[model samples]
Target: MLDTGCSVQGEQGDIPKEHPVLKSEKEVLEKVKLEQYQQIASARDLTDEEFSSLKEAHDTPPSERYAMGKYRLMAVYNICDTTVVTAQWVADYDNEHEKKVYRDLCVLSTSKMQDGLNYIHRMEQLSLSYSIENTFEARIPHKLDDSQYIKLKYAVDILAACGFSGPFSNDTVTAQTLNDNVNQYWELTKDKMQHTCTTLGLKMPMPKKWVFKCQLGFLNMVLHSVLGMKIGSVNTRRKMYHLKHHPKV
Candidate 1:
């Protein structure tokens, strides 16, 4: 979950002094109004027509769209991530200078690849604790200076193979990576884990696949609680069905 309420910790310590992208009060306000609409849609699951009607009605003479846009940008920066803002009062201005601010803000806000990488790390730790029986080790040879895009891609591939998705797979690395070697040590040998439940006399109580689903659901719940995003109910139902059909007696 994205920490929307986290504040910038100190005086913009490391941010470059002359970077661009800030907005005026008018643009900020416009953006805020739009975000409100987005929140309303999310909260109420409103239809397109309903939203359009609301927007049309709200549109007024001497429109404050510019101000609203600026407000929305600031709000997003203020809440989602604070590494973007350079000046404190960029959102207050209404002149051409405000355009520069808006431009800079857009660039900074969207360039959060590092943030995504950090999320991958968190997901990896959570997955290992939930699924693997052994402790996690740092075997994957990740570059300390690798681009965020590469890190994100690597994490996604690892997770998909492990039968999970989203941030859950953030720690997954290529099979040839050193991390894979470490993971192998922690993973229960499949034959051993399945032997008693599958080979025998005892009816397996729950299938391994189902167990994974339950884990995924639990993970999803954690993410929703933390990030404010909703996973679809269909996915939950599918997981439950898998568990029921593949139970270990």
Candidate 2:
């Protein structure tokens, strides 16, 4: 009699290898026609009013569309945990906007800073390679230097207002807090900030400070309200330890 294990292995080894069928030109053409028909059917099914409404909605700008989509998604999801969901939403939205803003700011700031540094580096290279008198005399005008300095100062101020501080704080804040604070801040002073930044030609950093403040507020809310965790405890650990040891009240 054949061993059961040997028979099973033999059956497994005899598994069929089925190759995927490559579509012919005729098949491809038929698929294209089918897709086109589906599209036409979908378009034809829509009423004139529906089509107009869809077109109007589509015409809305991306920023507005993003806002609408986000709110609609939130309404549809209706997640029970407001804290987590709201935080996630803020984080997602901020990710899209903040990433672009921060990246652009970094690029612009780094480019200008690097350019200035490069000039200094080049000057150093020249000084090392040849005497100062022998090298081409290229000096940054005091006015231009002063203007750049002012621009940098303005940028730093904008950054501070936006809430960008340093590494330690930014990572700790929740997205919900970031979103709420940013929206509030933006609504209150966006136009003013824009005008000021444009006038000064300053590159603003990411709003780290706003994020931190919002996060702190959220943490306080969670600690005091939701979780009921207090900041200080009067030997609660000792009380629990005694209760465990004594067994009776």
Candidate 3:
């Protein structure tokens, strides 16, 4: 949770002059935002419908409720690796600037990145800790330098495009650059990197593949695999049957 002890009013006039580093960082952020806005403004303006769709996709307006609410149950997104937590806030701003203060509390293993309110944001006040299921590296977001932010963002992109082999494999990787963020992530996950690098290539017993031909249901579903695509009335209406013989499973 953020420390809310300081008076919001006086800090504006007093803090920046006293803390030059804070001033400098805020300036850098201003420059970055200006560049972003300029790029957006330079684009061929979108149709109002397109703009509305994009805005709706981008933002979820926050609520005014500040106090902790009841612990209602919600479904979670499951993944196989590191934990990720994202918190969003439209900063406590006057109505005019509130739209511009939309910031994110992006926490990861070694970094905390936010747009507004430099270092002393409110979330620190909670005194919380996170634990990954089996790993014991503390999983704390360490101080991320500017360069590592690039690395972490790349790591995130690789995650977003998980199970995509056409881009990562050596044969098709000409589309990727040497210092690309995905490549950086490929380098950072050392165990994964070693496995990909071939510490040992052991032959495994031949595996059986499952092939089923089916059609007929409220929803028409077709699963395509290396075997082939086939249509069958397997589970339709009153009939549901498996293959007459097994493939030596």
| Per-model TM-score on C-alpha atoms | 0.20, 0.20, 0.17
Candidate 1: tens digits of C-alpha lDDT, residues 66-92: 334334555444434323332323333
The C-alpha RMSD in Å for every predicted model, in order, reads: 21.5, 29.6, 25.1
Which ten contiguous residues of candidate 2 have the minimum total lDDT?
Answer: 240-249
Which stretches of candidate 3 lie above 4 Å from their native place? 1-18, 52-249
Question: Which stretches of model 1 miss by more than 4 angstroms?
Answer: 1-115, 118-217, 230-249
TM-score of 2: 0.20
TM-score of 3: 0.17
Judging by TM-score, tell me the better candidate of 2 and 3: 2
lDDT of 2 by residue, 73-163 (tens): 3334443343433433443433333333333234334444335334544544555456445664554323333233333333333233334
Error of 2 at 20 (Å): 45
Better of 2 and 3 by lDDT: 2
In model 2, residue pairs whose N, Cα or C atoms come closer than 3 Å (at least 3 residues apart or on different chains), thus clashing, are 163-207, 163-208, 163-209, 163-210, 164-207, 164-208
lDDT of each: 0.37, 0.37, 0.27
Models sorted by lDDT, best on top = 2, 1, 3
lDDT of 3 at 242: 22
